[model samples]
Target: MFSLPIIALLVAGAQAAVLTLQSPRFTVSSSTGSQLRSEPISLAHASSIPVTLTKDDVLKLTFQVIDKESGKGVQPHQTFLRFYDQNSGEEGIQPIRVTNGGKAKFELNMARPPLSLPPTSDAPLQVSLLIGSSTYSPLALSLFDLIVPASHPVPAHPDEASFHPLPEIHHTFRPEQKLPPRPISALACIAVLAPWIVLLGLWGQVAPRAVHLFSPGIFPFILTLGAFESLLVWYWVDLKLGQVLSYGGVLALVTIFTGKQALSKIGDRRVGRK
Candidate 1:
């Protein structure tokens, strides 16, 4: 069997350990640099009284991350402080950077609160600590409840378009076109068919005396002309213009060669008779 990679084995070992916070503490101070309340955070339960911060007040937090199996401090991959409001269901997460020795400190000033701080209200915000490391199980501990001033009203949504009555729609359309009567349409059809009808009617009279017309050289020329006429009729009925044009071009070449041959044969026969 293949063995796991060294990095994978190392991560597995780390995950088997247990992670915990040591010396977790917080201090509330005034803007004039006087401490208001200072105490070590309890890991077992939340404090009876809620921590409150007015405008311009500051809150400082300090802690050390360590593996429970080994008392030595250890830095974890992720360390965050979460503030949540149960009533509004709004929460914010602020990342805290830990040193190589696992010591961490965070400062939250109400005058310049971090953007991660969510909109607040009269309700107390639940504060908690979250720690995660590749070498150990993740740890989360509820720290305390906090109260802050009510936030301003939420502004209008930037992506929403203005809603108002729109101007009445005025549509302009082309007038209906009138078509010709059936008798006129039939007359037009006759106008197109008259030449074909007259020529076909005269073909029988001309064919009997035209001995050269059915000959090999002239017959091909006549057939090519018929192909061109058929292609025109096919285009008018079903064939596309491009297809008819392609077939016509090829037929034109054949017609040119055949017509030249037929005319040359006629000229030779005339010379011989002379």
Candidate 2:
């Protein structure tokens, strides 16, 4: 007796050998009337034709399947159509099953309206199709070139009285609309340096003995101020909060090191005095 797995494999092989895909045919229609009734064309030898269509136009594609040995129509259980636009990189998939006649049909609506083109220019709307299935291999069809026609000019009214000149509009910049100067101000520079100067004075006056031992002088204060001002300038010019915070962290580390050195010098002096 055959095992269940063996039986399943045999059934799948039989199904694969029997099912065969045929060439697809299509028809195009617009608001005016039917445009084309294409003959069955093989997927390999399929050619693209430049087709001009309006937003109201519709295209219907028909895919047929048949038995390879018997040459009879075979209804597919399920079918999937993938339509892709090459230029826009847009894609859409539609699921449609075959009918009794082994024909699966789907309609494509042209929603993108046509634009005006120069006399020597042609804008190609490139599109392609793919038919996929779980049992059979995917079928890739040839590209389709679609063209949208420019809009027609509206006719002027026959009555001269109905026509009037449009109102005149002025396009001029006013004084109030002018942009403010972007240069950094002197007041801002003073504000950033003022705090450092005040701290240095306090350290000298309030702790005169300690200042003599741990006198870092103006060099450290100037270096730290310069670094902080550079960060401030970068923040103002680039307006990057992340860079400001990163540079600020580095400045914090520098300040901490300077403070520790001053404290150590003062501690050493106290021990010496003791």
Candidate 3:
């Protein structure tokens, strides 16, 4: 009787050992959007996937993980869902937690904030999925992006072709227009020194100074020269270097103009610096 009990204990221990050796390895199955995987999934296989979506549409994904040997389900602590754009290389990811016997599901809404939809339709949007690994398995999806074109909502048909609405007729220039030949830097330089040059040129004619202010066309000459010079400076400072040179230019111009006014007044005794 004692021997029989020992044999029963040995059999139980062996069964427990088998179960311990049989824990699951993860596999991925996906039903994403309208696309479905048609072949056995493997690390080496390449998958061609497609999705269909309309602007402001929402989508859901259902997938599973399973044990390779016993056909039991498996779930991971953390899994990531990703959206990829094939053309522009844009992508987004959301984390999903698996529960209730290794089943995972994800829902994503398709909407654009700075919406670009149509009138236009069938724009290509490709997608790819990444699970836990850095490399995505051979599964991906694609879609067509539809955006409202600029021509949409045709401006309220003018009361008459010649009614000529002022608002419509007026051109809206891009804020980036005139772009300073570079940007704010060049524009700032022109703003700062321009007044000084103009005032100095005018003062040269009226003051008790020997400096030729405008004779020989120096005023216009210098003005034109500075304009071009500053353009190059603007490009160099703002465009090439990506630094704004205008702030320093403004401060220096203020100092120079004020100082000149003070000095001129002291020299000519005119209004204590004119």
Please report the candidate that would top TM-score against the real structure: 1
Two-way lDDT contest, 1 vs 2, winner: 1
For candidate 2, write residues 152-243 as lDDT tens digits. 43345777434777668898866686544545566677788999998998898886553353256434645676788888997898858987
TM-score of model number 1: 0.52
Clashing pairs in 3: 116-147, 116-148, 117-147, 117-148, 118-147, 118-148, 123-145, 265-273
Q: For candidate 3, give the lDDT.
A: 0.45
Residue 130, model 1: lDDT of 90
Please give the ranking of all candidate structures by lDDT, highest first, separated by commas.
Answer: 1, 2, 3
lDDT of 1 at 96: 96
1 or 3, greater by lDDT: 1
CA-lDDT, candidates in order: 0.87, 0.61, 0.45
Model 1, C-alpha of 210: deviation from truth (Å): 99
lDDT for each residue of candidate 3 in 1-274, tens digit (9 for 90 to 100): 6769878877755543111112211222233434322223233332333344444444555556544445565554445554444444544455656664656655544454222221222334433344332221222322222221122332556565656645546787768645445668877888988999989998989877646455442344445446556756777765643233564465456546655654454466545542
Report the CA-based lDDT of candidate 2 relative to the real structure: 0.61
> Candidates' TM-scores?
0.52, 0.38, 0.29
Ten contiguous residues with the weakest lDDT in model 3:
17-26
Query: Mind sharing the TM-score for model 3?
Result: 0.29
RMSD of 1: 16.5
